[model samples]
Target: MASTSSGGTVELSGFFADLVRCETRLYNALNDRLRERHGIVTSQFEALRYLRDHPGSRVADLAAEFAIGIGATSKTIDRLEKQGWAARQPNPADRRSSLLALTDNGTQLVGAAEKTFTAEVAELIGGTLDSSSATAAAQALSKLRSVLERNQIGTPTG
Candidate 1:
């Protein structure tokens, strides 16, 4: 247990702490591997993968989906553009927002990286947790995410 500044004690086994620690560890491993093999970090790979799946999505759309700021999303897009992995086109519906798309190079890179990503996840997660445990954890996390999203927690207007 840890004492909070507010004179309360927090359980060390809290789900939030565990979730964050797990996420950090997983993210760092994925980031390192992706950067080593794909020449892009995990964030870039994720953005590219999303763009591949949701072609012509706007920066704001990406920002909302990733729960990040528009400025940060734009910077990521800018980096992708610089690397010739992504491009922006004028949006037909919204003049102020540009549609984002992955380039052919990005498409190929992400496809390859997806394989690596899957393998790493399987090796890291599958190696530790059994199938049933993994499924349960995923389901629980999904439920939590739904609840948070539904409540507008951490949302821009929350």
Candidate 2:
């Protein structure tokens, strides 16, 4: 690991590269496992889990939380609806937007998938890093995420 020094600050190019690569690899692994076991990909599992936790959320809310576009989120929701895992209800508060909720099938599937997700995370991440190192890494990443979110950095503008 090499760090380049600019003035008095250290450039984190390697750190950024590692972060992106690690995220991609981890996501792929999780997606593969979830698809194999639950017949749903990681994104679907995440959306279902979110709907389970926050019933009556709108599609826009899911898009915002996932940092994706509305079109993409709507597509995912469409697939879920077709699979009978989720449904959209008319929003009395807003005629234009509908609220989302997980169906009974979705609830059962997500509950089972949650166990697999937890075990995989434990095997992959927990097995790789020690307790203290994992804690420190999570804390650092959380702080960085907070700063970026607070500043709205890298958010899509239209």
Candidate 3:
């Protein structure tokens, strides 16, 4: 049997439950939609996006960023490489670790997919909030993310 443990009283548990439910729904929606439309999982998209922006990130650094095991991270990289979306080159500083970067095709794919994803999200909530309010919400969410990271809770999953 499952027992419910409220954080305390009525207020906290309701809020936390809603947040967790929303998180799961959002993850599934975004990941499934992106994968179906672009043939890229959310994790792979994140890795590619990071590589596209950073251009020389190592597997270890990426693993740390995604909070995933190295073998899993390497498998993502391998899939991306097999698809010609990314490539690995020997690091000048360290022979043991290689630097990963997005290829031209990868960059183009990410750009298109990102635009699609952004437009979809904007369409979903654009009518509910005005630009200023949306901006504020984004800022608030960013702060919340920082707080969660600082507290070492609700970390990103790879």
Best by TM-score: 2
lDDT of 1: 0.90
Residue range 5-100, candidate 1, lDDT tens digits? 463776756857888999999999999999888888899989999999998899988888888888899999999999999999999998988999
Runs of candidate 3 with Cα error greater than 4 angstroms are 1-10, 127-136, 151-158
Best by lDDT: 2
Model 3 local distance difference test score: 0.80
Q: What is the C-alpha local distance difference test score of each model?
A: 0.90, 0.92, 0.80
Q: Between the candidate structures 1 and 3, which one is better when assessed by TM-score?
A: 1
The digit string of per-residue lDDT tens for model 3 on 1-158 reads 23344533446567668768965776676688788889887777788888988889998788777767788889999999999999999999999999998889999989977876786667655756799988976896799778876886754454
Score every model by TM-score: 0.90, 0.92, 0.76
Model 1: worst 10 consecutive residues (lDDT sum) = 1-10
Tell me the lDDT of model 3 at 125: 57
Q: Which candidate, 1 or 2, would have the higher lDDT against the true structure?
A: 2
The clash numbers for all candidates, in the given order, read 0, 0, 0
Residue range 1-158, candidate 2, lDDT tens digits: 45545535544886788999999999999999999999999999999999999999999989878878889999999999999999999999999999999999999999999999999989999999999999988998999989988897866552
What does the lDDT come to for candidate 2? Answer: 0.92
Which residue runs does candidate 1 get wrong by more than 4 Å? 1-13
Descending-TM-score candidate ranking: 2, 1, 3
Tell me which residue pairs clash in candidate 2. none
